[model samples]
Target: MEYCSLIQLKTTMMNNFLTLFIAAFVFISCAKEKDPIIGNPGLAAQGEWSIPLNRILDGGPGKDGIPALDEPIFVSPQEATYLDDDELVIGHSSAQESKAYSHLVMNWHEIANDWFGQEPVAVIYCPLTGTATGWHRKLNNQVTTFGVSGLLYNANVIPYDRNTDSNWSQLTLECVNGELIGTRPEMVNLLETSWSTWKTFFPDTEVLSTETGFDRSYGVYPYGSYRTSEGLIFQVKDSDDRLHPKERVHSIISGDYVKAYRFSNFPETAAGIILDNVEGQNVVVIGSQTQNFIVSFFEKQINDEVLTFSLPSDDLYTNGNFTSSVILTDQFGNNWNAFGYAVTGPNEGDQLTPTMGIMGYWFPWTSFYTTVDIYGEQ
Candidate 1:
């Protein structure tokens, strides 16, 4: 009896120790920033998300509509020019003539500065580890330097400098993950200098294919030290300010975190979904014609049961297309939902007529449920 008691006591102590260790790991590492609104990549039934036929966000150094800047990075087109628009200039990097999509420099820069605004982010996307990282790159006429800001996901920021390089003679990075990879000027020559050229930088990275509806695993940020893969690692407007999936140049426009979509004019086949107990849900609330859809959650799936609700079309949209305010909540009690309308179908004499349609602008057709915190995760 004495020996059995001793064994039991040891087992109990061991179990307690393990429980404490696990608790500490979760407490120390599983820290999530308190974000109210989460982006859900609403996946459709066909296992495809709807990708706009046209690319909404424009890139490159020089372009119309956008104002010019002091940066030297420019498109390699016959008439290379300075970039004016912030969005178009977001990804512009002075890489080797071969590697137009060289992100190694950009990732180093972005990783240094957690925030990416109008300035350029030197990017490096490694598909093997699914790591998409960047750096804030700056170059003068003769010299160049790379800054490293260790701001990672779900952790306190770490500021560190890796190296200082002045002679950036040939801008290209070498990638070898159990194999070999490098971008040569010849590869750039073969590409038509389109976005595909940029994608070549991440041969193994996953990007949202124009042909596919599925969004690349763009927002997946892991804890500790891990590499990023090639995904939608490019710069984009803040979630609130992002353009509709279909609006090409307009979607990439940078500025205020504007509310661009509503739910009033949701298609007849569309269904409204409500998530209960959403702790950290950043979902892109999409109303589509079929039940097929995908929404990414901080957790593989939301813990709470989802409820479906319907608001009359008449109350939602003046025409036939509309977006509802996104709702994020911690519990079912406080639901934050808003709405935006799309100018797709014919709504004769509607104020949001095609003639008045601005690609990325949102006009209020129906009042949002402001009573709830749209940014709060339920």
Candidate 2:
């Protein structure tokens, strides 16, 4: 299945979403007659926006135009034949469970609202910017599902909570407008990597099913040539030409500082580890081009002790090489998985402290943090 051209995508979106936006405008018209303010107008929508209003582009589809998935379906790794090995996925995992949201389904519907055990989570992806994050589905203890506001800031998705109609900037990691202004959504750390690498490491993982209720081409990318092209469909607030705009990078954000860690900086021929620091936080980054993965975790352990990590030795574990995503062996002999969870050792049940990290295209991260730092850059 080939990607829908810009014309075809817009036509399809219009066909599916026209009625939803029609109703929105109707409500706005009625609300405007009674008072100057309206509810979710799809035009500056609501509240005094934290971002410069001029920067918010009118992403063609109006509110709920590009539908978000609710109560998404999932299948076992073997059942996910629609995915290819090299294709990437955003993973949200824990000791109890692990799930992979493939880019194939995400390209059509950018958000998937689902439950991971008892807690609600919204897997938010911005296809244009190639950024994905898992947001806890709650605000001040009240549960809510997020929807596509049909808006773009820095060419990234602006998700609004159904409970309060507040708009959130995915890359900015905060609410920029509406009732929940200035509030930041609680986030779950998500690891991004290729399907081959993920399924190899986590054979028992649940993959997001292509059986989404919406009728979309599951394997085809909706946006044409956007992934490889240097052009952005919408403008960003800031940009830097140090790296190709679409080159994917793992970013660790702390307070006001953001560090971009590239796969090129690590040894690609074989799995490698980089013990580094980001904004005073010691970190261990592991990756390999052969494995098609790169990930990071805070070096501070659950016991509050900082430990040095290295590639597993042949003599230590079972046989020749330590395969799977058990990419690190700490001095204490704990083997840590890509998700930062300890799989073996005295602290076996404990999880490594996760940093505020996300993987996305280089431009989006740089645009968000104008002063973004590139590791190994001279």
Q: How much lDDT does each candidate structure score?
A: 0.25, 0.81
TM-score of each: 0.23, 0.85
Candidate 1: list runs displaced more than 4 Å: 1-13, 21-121, 124-136, 139-144, 151-253, 258-378
Per-residue lDDT of model 2, residues 1-378, tens digit only: 345587798888897798888897786666445422212344553658987676677688888998999879999988888988999998877777889999998877899998887999999999988889999997888989999998888788999999998889998899998888899888888888889878867878999998888888887888889999987766666778999999988888987678988879876466778888887778878777676667888876545667878777664323323356576777788888787877888778667777787888988775677468999984
Cα lDDT of model 1 overall? 0.25
Tell me model 2's lDDT, rounded to 2 decimals: 0.81
Best by lDDT: 2
